[model samples]
Target: MSYFCGSYPIIEKKALAGQIYSYTLLCPQIAENAHIGQFVQIKAEGYMLRRPISICQTDKEKGTLRLVFEVRGGGTDKISQLGAGDMMDIIAPLGHGFTLSDAPNGKVIVVGGGIGVPPMLDIAKKYGENCTAILGFRSFDRIILDKDYFATGARTVLCTDDGSVGIKGTLAAPLKEELKSGAAAVYACGPVPMLKAAAEEARLAGVPCEVSLEQRMGCGVGACVVCACTVIRDGKKQVLRVCKDGPVFKGDEVVF
Candidate 1:
């Protein structure tokens, strides 16, 4: 995919939750070429390494790209403090994304946990009414983009671990039922445990599944082996870079 690296002015900035912030940037080139599930790497102020955030939303006509992130450390905290009109250095549309081509005709299940929920928004929008989203959060306050998913005409099921909202359990609660209804495909992103469970469920249901992995990265590119993940390819297990080889892989291929 074509990518652009440059400084872009923030057009909008808002806090979605307690420590979660959503920043929209005016970068036409990146907005136009970015695919669903792709991510952008932003250079954190005074930090040597960049922070990779998934592409939350994009508007090619408006020349904007949105990124949602939590203030987890000094780098992300620096990003959360920036206001509109602030210019930030970023490399856009890096890493492989989910494949829509493999999606089944009738309905596709999109699952996300915690921060992973943002990337699923674009996929729901792309699939429209044919998409069914299962989002899990730690609690009510952690919930995000529920309205956004509804606006896209996708059926959404929200769950919280603490039983403070919607269904009280893991995403697997709703996911198991969805799989029983039959789906063309399944796509997910979240913590390793959540992903592993979803992958297993998909396998049992005989549905094709894709998962986006999260890892610590020294470089946004594959030059560093920091984000290496083990995958079963062609009957053999091999280590692949999440940044270069894929942040998205077939659920069955991942070694977990």
Candidate 2:
């Protein structure tokens, strides 16, 4: 709930894919308290509202936070123009993040699709060899973070829509395979269809699951009604704000 708002210096920026870029910022205050699934509200120059970007990785000791984002529109296009050495405006760490299990588990599965892939990195990195990451993309060209996931020492499964990469299909097959072996828990973030399927699969498998909802936010914070999603909490349907209530929620609770 506690957050920081400031202009942080961009330490490094790397081009990941065609329109995707990774930025590392020097922000001690934000990095010091950032959690595995929290995000930052970044100010895009010349734009009225800030864009929400997930915290890809955070190094508390080094006082740095990494954000991987794609140039999706005018606001993000402006954000993409900034390079290393520029001061970036950000308010973080915002929203509820994933409730990560403190101890390492031999069986944990993390799923992500397209732009949703970035947030899964933090959990994969933390769980290391104990985690299995099933990542999906439209094609080989759209794929990002394969090497990065592998570098985390987590078992990485790659899937593409065109079969130009690992497996040509959705994450369903592999997810079911992993669950068959028994998973302690499942975590996911991606397109709603994907999230829904993953949540259902985990539910049927009787594995506890958590999912990060990908929502467009006008205020980044809970002030605006822009990011509302209905979820069944306490056996009742309740409207919730993705920015305030969560980007992360228990899988079965999501109405999607």
Candidate 3:
């Protein structure tokens, strides 16, 4: 896929808990080109490496893309300083995206944990009532986008490790329950353990599954080889660049 590199205006900005932020950028070409499960690389002032952030939402007709990201380190911290009306240097529509569907069944279930929740919002909106979102967070304060998921008209299940809000544990039990009924596919993005569990559940349920990975990246494209992941394809285990080949991959393909 072709990528566009430019400075875009930040049209809206909002801060969420844990130094997490939602910034809506008015980049017509990038918005039109972006896909769900893809990401944007933001060049932070004074940083040699750009920060790779997941694309939270996209409004192509409106020529905007919403990016939700946490302040992880120096690069992201520099980015957090920017707000509405600021020009953000970005290269976007990067990385492989989720396969919307590969199942005969029409319903899909999306699983997200912590900062991983944003991307699932778009998928749920696409599936509407046919989507069930099993979201896991550290605690209530850690929760973000539950309302957004609800706005998508999907059944939203919130699970927190601390039981401060929603269910008292991880997504395993609820996910298993949701799969029992019937689902066309399962999609996930979170920590490796969460991804592994979700993939395992989907495998047991006989559902096609895909997952987005969170990796340390240097170049947001294929160049730097900083974000490498192992996967099995055609019976051969191979190393792949997460930024180029995928931040998204088939659940079965990932070695985990």
Candidate 4:
């Protein structure tokens, strides 16, 4: 399908955290086709370039798509201030999603850090009870959507740099415990550092793993190579488009 750029009708907008906002946009076409880990590029104002944000959820029947974003800079700061009745220009359901075709559906491990946890939520919803979610943040105040994740029926583990939540360390620590026990597969999303650590940990445990990467983009779609990333395939270095080939890729194939 051709990439279509249009305005999104906002149905709901609410604060998720201090500067984080959750927007439920009405987009029947994109919602019907969205997959776990896929994202949409949206503009905060008319005539502005779009910023890519991962799709948090999609309800095709309801014609709604959700996105959770924090006010990290100018783009997101403008987004957080948008109201329910506001209209947003968006191009969505872009990029490749998670590869679940070979997923075992048995004892899956998911690790997320900070805002990176949002994309993993859709994955957890699809896998349900078979998945275990491990999340990390700097502190309790920075934590955003734990309760909803717990409601997914996946065994949820929370970690904070400080001892304010479930665990007092990074996700790798508890993830190691799960791997040692017997996790079938591991999926992760987070800052580059956390993902690097998780990839290394997964390698040591000898478990298959996939990671979702977030990068800056000048154009939300594949037309622009602004989000090109390096990956290794069959011992060869290849450049992949985060907007097209994948935001999700096997841990071993990615270059940390």
Q: Residues 4-104, candidate 1, lDDT per residue (tens digit)?
A: 89999998998898899889999999988988888888998899889989989988899899999988999998878899989979998889988996445
What is the lDDT, from 0 to 100, of the residue 176 in candidate 1?
93
lDDT of each: 0.90, 0.92, 0.92, 0.85
Tell me the tens digit of each residue's lDDT in model 2 across 178-254.
Answer: 99998888999998999999999999999999999878898887898799999998889999999889989999999
Winner of 3 and 4 under lDDT: 3
For candidate 2, the per-residue lDDT at 232 reads 94
Candidate 3 similarity to native, TM-score = 0.97
* Number of backbone-clashing residue pairs for each candidate, in the order shown: 0, 0, 0, 0
Q: Residue 245 error for model 2, in Å?
A: 0.6
TM-score of each: 0.97, 0.98, 0.97, 0.94
Error of 2 at 25 (Å): 0.2
- Please provide, for model 3 over 1-256, each residue's C-alpha lDDT reduced to its tens digit, 9 standing for 90 to 100: 7899999999999988878999999998998888999999999999888888999999999999999998988889999999899999999989999888633367899999999999888999888898999999999998898889999999999999999998888888899999999899999999999999999999999999999997889988899898999999999999999999999999999998
Model 2, position 35: C-alpha lDDT score:
89
Better of 1 and 2 by lDDT: 2
Cα RMSD to native, each candidate?
1.2, 1.0, 1.2, 1.7
Residue 153 shift from truth in candidate 1, angstroms: 0.8
- Between the candidate structures 2 and 4, which one is better when assessed by lDDT? 2
Candidate 1 accuracy as lDDT: 0.90
